[model samples]
Target: MKLAVLIHGLLAITPAAAFAGYSLDVRLDRSDGFYKVGDETVCTATLMNDGKPAVGEKLRCTVKRERDILRRDEFLCEGKAVTVRASMDRPGWLFFGFEIIGPDGNPLQGEGIFKHRMKTTIVGEIGAMYDADKITALDSRPADFDAYWASCRCKLDQVPLDPKLTEIDVPRALRGKVKCYSIEVRCQGRTPVTGYLAVPVKARPQSLPACVDYLSMVWQDASRTVPAEMASKGVLALYVSWHGLPTGKTADEYKTIAQTWYEEGGKAGDTDRDTWFGHDMYLRVMRALDFIKSRPEWNRKELVVRGGSLGGIQSIAAAALDPDVTLAIVSVPSGCEYNGYKQGRDAAALYRGKEAVARIEADPRRAVTLAYHDGVNLAPRIKCDIYVCTGFSDELCTPSSVFAFYNALPATTKKFMSTNPRTGHYGTTKNTAGDKRLSDIFRSVTVYD
Candidate 1:
């Protein structure tokens, strides 16, 4: 390849997304995103310096495994191609990376982060962290799981949903007669639930449907997009924060508040039912639901709940606890099959790590207490139509745990799960299939009532 021709005509110009100065890429052998377990798949890496292969450059290529395996060679990359072979004994995802050696004896900015899926079956989602076919969730459900949650629900019911709303000015373009408010509603404990609530302005109070979009771990999320837009469609919308911080605060203020929660963040919450974060989270969500349906504007029959990551956990828990929820969409959810860590199957097993495990092991009863809050344990109780979306390459929320959660749903419950092989936790691309499914879901929602 001619260097001038490649630089001037072939390489696409970009401000930032590509590698800083050099262009690098890697492609695996399989186009369908699958490899038979133990089958060696060749990963070919290519680096272009000003669009021409640098004949004498040294590079490092690696595959992530139980322990990362690193290989370096100058001759391998000389011929405009460098091949690294990888195979996994178990069905799972593989991460491959490439780097060019810099003059300072450090790796350069160019990198190839292509991934692969090793599998035994030609069917189903590939690159999953655990074998979907062989997945089994350790049953951590406490014998008193039902009785305990029932008691919790009763406690939540006692808290008066003294809902208060402070109206906010909507951008003129979004106003269109829809009203938005910063909402605070009392819940199971004194912390209270906080979020944005948007309802359609009415001549007299009018009944409406509702949509719930729970939030992620990010700090101050502004805008009342859900409820404000849904108002146009005759649906009430609520987006609640998992942490009970006042909505509409400045982003820096929210950041300061969020840092304080870090003191309360971790496995330390596993002492018992009252201490667990899940306990507060779910009860608050249930309370949010109470506030939603209790509105004179509530149609009472239609409720949609959804979110991704930690928010997904809230969505699943809300639908499980509230029979009024007509639909639940959980994407890349956490809080599922935590016990998979014990078996070395949870991909991000080291995330919470040993000290967290020690807390659970400190008392048998504490482990049992966590069982009541596991998302998989509550899945069977969900009565609504549910859709689960997971990424095969998502290490944080392992797809196997998702499969366990999905498979445990009762036979009578209508459900569907979609997985993309290439995407990681936050990189879910715009997928046409996903769009079609979502269209079908809300499309049906309009008619289900």
Candidate 2:
């Protein structure tokens, strides 16, 4: 069966050398870059100078199953492409990594005009997946998952939601059409639920459908214009910052605060479910919903939460935890199948790598903590209509882990999954045709009245 609509795109390439026109280009035999179990695809790694092949250049190539190296070899680019055939026995990814090595038995360096040789290694990757739909979660859901979340909600309920709204100016064209504000809602966490809210200037009470949009993992403040853009389409929209930090800060200020949070407090008491980072994360999600529902202009129906990557995680959690969320749309989501390594594949990016995997394995409590945060475990609880998008070649949110979460959803839930065969974690593809189709899908769900 044709499992996905193939998104053809230019092969991934390494950045060009600062002084030299040297780079590595990697491509797959199948433009779509997908395979079934036991199927093989040819990976071509070519050393290029300017635009043509770098004749007589020596290349070192390695193949990997995610981060686990499978094979290593050397080839000479003698006016031709160096190729390797790779396959996966299970539902997972295969990566081809390439580098140029000098005849002196070291990685090649770029030569500059002033006789300065920069230590720049031309490296690129070609990634693909096999039988992705068959992937399943390796970690089991905690027995008290529901009870744990219930207690969290109880604490949140005790805190009154004292919402503060600062009306912000809109552009000349949008001044009469929409009104924007920076909003802060009190939450159980130390920080408030901060975001931008936009409403149609003439929207009638109880007439506008509401949407709660979650921002992706970033150190910068949330976009101030996104909610206004959405409101222009006649929807009541709120764009929330995942960190719940104060908005209108300088970029550097936001980055410094985010860094401090990451180092000192992000994972504090991680082994304890009550004090875990996710505890506050979910509190923000719940508070965002409460504030949106409180709006007089809200339709009292059709609440949608949508995002991608880190935002995807919040969107999924919001739908599962809040019965009022009517729909969820996500793409290339992280935090799914957090213990995926236990299945012999790489875990979600947050928990990937040898050190992180070993640490989780050493502590049973950590595993339990992650189980509560795992999207796969939460999937079965989502009763809303859901839509998903994933790239077969994604390294961050591996297709296997994504499928694990998708498979765990209740069979009766209205759900759809779209795949981009040659895309990566960022959804980069050369197929303009296919990319337009994907955009259309998102616009339909996110911009509705």
Candidate 3:
């Protein structure tokens, strides 16, 4: 997605020390303002400290629903000023306004209306078999796959790792046996990407396996913590971020540009710029691998990449394009069968351009472009072993898509594990059981005598 720049001039406020005051600003950075039934929309509001920057201990932004489209009945927001935190939920638009309540009992309000739309394809009550069959046909041909990825390759020379373009530093607060570092990898474009890297202090030479995780909507940052349990297992972990994250103050802060990247039609000659969604992320993952392989302490040959949701999607893509990736563990990944998935759905509702979807569907070329980034397409191309885990209740990523990718795996050593979780889009209570099984499987396949 193209990054959005907030054009509102800064509002500077000065207040007398004896008096207390507050101000609220409501502006839509970029809003088409219309949505279909099932689409997800993000609206951002910036609240400025207009009064004596209070000595308050707490601040909050509450989104209250005014209209109930898509039956979105909740409000979710995470993080404070200057940090981009997010409230994770299924796809839908927010219909409420935001209010900030200060510690001293002062309330500032910002109000706006937004809508969410559903893509056209999945709108009706069609059976799963029809949807599955349509997707299978669209995704089946290898030729279609080749055409989609034709332009996605970055010449080995184009991979951005110049010391001049990127910077690496270890935070003093993180300095210790913990072994953590902050990395800023500059994309050729205007936006600079940043992420965190951590490794176990105690790891055997060849056993220092590394795992690179691609974050979802959240940006990569120091505050982001990986489960200590994973690190304790002697695996080096890196979190690569997209959007304004790892840098932006709020997930909503990055929504403008994020939406642009997935805009309706192919802008100019760009058939599928969204392909870079995985390409750029995978590039950063590989760069993290480069950093780990450079360390005398790590085992360069034992590298694994895993993620759930968006990260899961990247894991599969990276494994497909980069032969060095030894193992991939993916869960509930999005962006599998675009055309098939978007059919019958309102274009705006699907977070895509109506004209764009129509154009892509009419022309086989667009499907060709999608093939390069499709995890299902890449799954069969991965040379290494794969462990796939999917939740039966996942809504964002249908169980059918996960099974499609799993069945496509060309690796003879691949394994499949399904969890019938009552929850949607998350691993089961047996996640630990699944992890142990994966670790054992990796040891069996990759460990040398």
Candidate 4:
């Protein structure tokens, strides 16, 4: 995207002596364009002062999607030149507008509307694209065995589990019948993770079945609230944080962590260390499970993992990675196949690499590395019962991705429920019905004394 500006002079005879002045003009290059979801695109805006040039000015570009502001980039104008580049990581309709402020800190009055037209191309495959291929690949890789457990044990040795419960204030909603506590666990790399623990106040402390709940894309902290309605039914709910639970700080700290994680290339070791977005987040979910198993207060026999959206993806992935988790429930999970879902020109916009699927097909490691973080791959690895929910109206995470994962599950006890098409991503209470069903399934499968 590019913007250009021009200036025209006007002379007036009746205004205090002969006065002449020029009005600023601006225009952007590639005013209207289409991009693939997740693709990054650059736009440059140029401003001219009185036909010469204006240097050392400040430039600001504001991007909006629907009514919500997406991102803003502010920069110091270089001698007669300034360019602002922005990338859209998620899929959605986006609108962009820019303004150049002179050194005096006033908007350079311009004569142009300064408009930008945005379009999107849906890219990549969901789960259904390579179902058979993935299944075949898993089959060739010797079935998961006791040896795998040994390898995992060795890996666990590197990361000692510290299971410590810190008494915390329970939500007013859960104060009476359910007591809430926060648990902190240490991961292999000294990564500290915190999760919420809710136990029925009336229930005995020993040998109680526990449910490990992974939070959505949002951060989880002490103040985080769980549906007390579920705890009332005799389940010990553990709300695990996906983005390393936040410490008790101001709201600004929480917002910063959420946005900072995906700034440049993603987090460490995975892709672009400078950029803090990618699949490494899934590993954090696995670590949360490790924490749960390390706990003596929670029964290891009836472990359950559940979440929605990104959290849903983690739940499915955790169940697949760890056999100790006996049950899994996921709703509207994201991150599926890379090549299959990303397709066409718009798809190319969403990705940082090449556009053609054939190019990716020949050497898919680059894309596969990214997909390693996807829940689709994790779903088939789960050996226990699984429950999945899909929303027909979900725009952020398409129903196709959800179905792809649901169909890919190797678990014989897997079940799926879909909400009415009228509902979208916003309203999720209806999906909780599936959770109740899952609770029932968990009870039926266990022979509790």
Candidate 5:
């Protein structure tokens, strides 16, 4: 057996990143479309080089099973066509992709997907198969896990939530009928929580539901931090930035500040719970929840939280820590099954990295401290509704690890878990079944009037 690896999911080679002299664009006849198991799945690609067929160019296709390449083939990029034919022996995920050496000698690649359905799910596990309901987390609940978080929550409660809101003049792209605000709230940490708050100018803010888009692993942009459509859906929406910086900065200013913060924060936090790089982000989220609950315009029973990847981790953590959260929508969530590597499987970047491996090896206390942030360790404590979209072949956040988190939920918890075929490290949208479930979850909560 041979091992193949790519530090995928953080980012992959896309056509947009192609060499400037010759750029590539890929399109499928259809994507995230339907298919039946055992049906001949003929995958094809149009390799356009600067809007023309990439004639005489060498193109390669690699099909994957999880992180492993199941097969590889090469052909000339002629007639604007390249094809890879494959079929799921049974209902499961399949991936088809293309790569070519750019004029600069760097590889540029693109991908397309089709989900094979069996009327029900097949191949429920990604790496190291197990019963979805039976998979257990390797980290047992720390004896003080409940007590520690309880103390933190109580400490947070004792802190006075001095909140401030100011109307912001955003670019037209982010401005309109909705009134947007720059919001600030003092949490348990030295830094205050910050984000953009949006409310429908025509609707009574109190009359609508409330939603928080926690944010993704990618550092957020100060401009357009909040989704403009959030207000149209009958909700007062707040988009929180983990950086806790004021919104509305020039692009260069934002980038410089973010780079500085990452350098300062990532290098300094490794000693304890208080110093961990993520402690402030999570604590501030809880404080932000407190602020949301305090608003008279917010429906007390309709607070919904949503995120993907790292944001998904925060959303789950927030729901577990706060019983006031009503619904959580998470996608390809990281921070799950951190110790799955113990079983010859891989873990998400958040949990299983060179730094983490070193910490565990250097001192046992580091691992103990990290368990406090593990999403799987927090899953059983969640009591609200959860809708998660996970890829059957997400190498970044392994499906098996996500199942471990899902399986441990309280038996009474209302939850839905859906998968996309070979949809590695991406989000679910309305076009996919998992995304439809999320839409329905929110739809049920929106008031018609």
Candidate 6:
């Protein structure tokens, strides 16, 4: 399939102002930055001072195969743009990143040039993907992948699913129109599935379609209290938090928990599949689906799952693990093609290359356990209509890995993929149009009006 046209038009100059009236603009020979294997991709890097070409400026440039460095050199901006050419023999990405350096071999200092806290000093980048659709998971699907997940389902079945619902205040406009509550459901894990549920106050039994919204990885409290405005259109909306921690907790409480998670990290229990952190995460996903289906107000005809980044990962799991899910919308999803780094592509799991490989090599069980959770392996069983949005510029969940997941989906599954070349991860840039498109799809699936 050809790259989305909407993505080609999204590329533009960097939005931030450069320091000391200096700016760097990077561009690819082809705006979309897609190429066939063995095709050379050229990146033009230009430096400007007060909107004019900064002649005689020195640029330190590096070409990388994902995170692996390939070449590093210096170029002179002699009243024109300097070019760097790179290519990949296999399906993957080649990133050409450059920064302005002074004659003293030190990076130029200015207002936006140095961000101490972020540890990111690079000024500009051009990312290119070669034969992206041809990329696949480095590791084969374990033979027991199905049997393992089936056992997880059976284990979750034994849990009581004792749901607790507490009425909560809604925005003034929704006071009479919508009934909102804080909901918790017991599952097989140490924590319960917790989130906010919004239902139309006047809906009759089996009247409204259901939507389960997954939040992106959250470390602090945010306004996850309300559903999209469309929830009032006769949709039963459940906003599930990834961490089963209480909703609306004091800031300090959340801070303490986040610190603990940060230090322990997501890979804490990966050695054994049964105790792997992902095991409990999937359990919560299955239980959340159960809780939504249990609602008397559910129409029993339509169920939608939607999220971005980490939430996207869970959304994929939800649809794959449950046959009831009719639609899934995900963007910039991580946790895909977990072992891709072994093939020189970036790993989309919680850890990076060497560390991730070491864990798998150290224990045969880890390899099997990770395959069970890899999105590429799970994509084939989704069987639901899917809408995926990705950013070619995203490093956390690289475009190559996202494409691998998309390619793994069954040919008969109704699906669409859209992208923005300028957006990265989540906050680096926003895809307003793509977001609206996804919202429209969600509304179509659940909106009663």
Candidates in order, TM-scores: namely: 0.79, 0.85, 0.56, 0.57, 0.72, 0.88
lDDT of each: 0.64, 0.75, 0.45, 0.50, 0.62, 0.75
Candidates 2 and 5 compared by TM-score, better number:
2
> Which parts of model 6 are misplaced by more than 4 Å?
1-6, 16-23, 48-57, 102-111, 114-119, 222-228, 250-252, 261-263, 428-438, 441-449
**lDDT for residue 322 in candidate 4, whole number 0-100:** 78
Q: What TM value does model 3 have?
A: 0.56
Q: What's the lDDT for candidate 4?
A: 0.50
Per-residue lDDT of 103 in model 4 = 64
lDDT of 4 by residue, 40-100 (tens): 5454444333443446656666654422456877767554544544444443334344566
Q: Candidate 5 lDDT, tens digit per residue, 327-355?
A: 88777788776666565455555546556
Q: What is the lDDT of residue 258 in candidate 5?
A: 70
Best model number under TM-score: 6
Q: Which regions in candidate 5 have their CA more than 4 angstroms from the true location?
A: 1-98, 101-136, 170-177, 202-206, 222-228, 263-267, 351-356, 426-449
| 132-203 per-residue lDDT for model 3 (tens digits) | 212232444556554444344454336555422122334454434345556565454323446666655555
Ranking by TM-score: 6, 2, 1, 5, 4, 3
Give, for candidate 3, the lowest lDDT window spanning 10 residues: 121-130
Residue 375 C-alpha lDDT in model 5: 84
Candidate 4 residue-wise lDDT at 150: 46
Model 5 TM-score relative to the real fold: 0.72
Ten residues in a row with the worst lDDT in model 6?
112-121
**Total clashes, candidate 5?**
1
Lowest lDDT block of 10, candidate 1: 1-10
**What C-alpha root-mean-square deviation, in Å, does candidate 1 show against the real structure?**
8.3
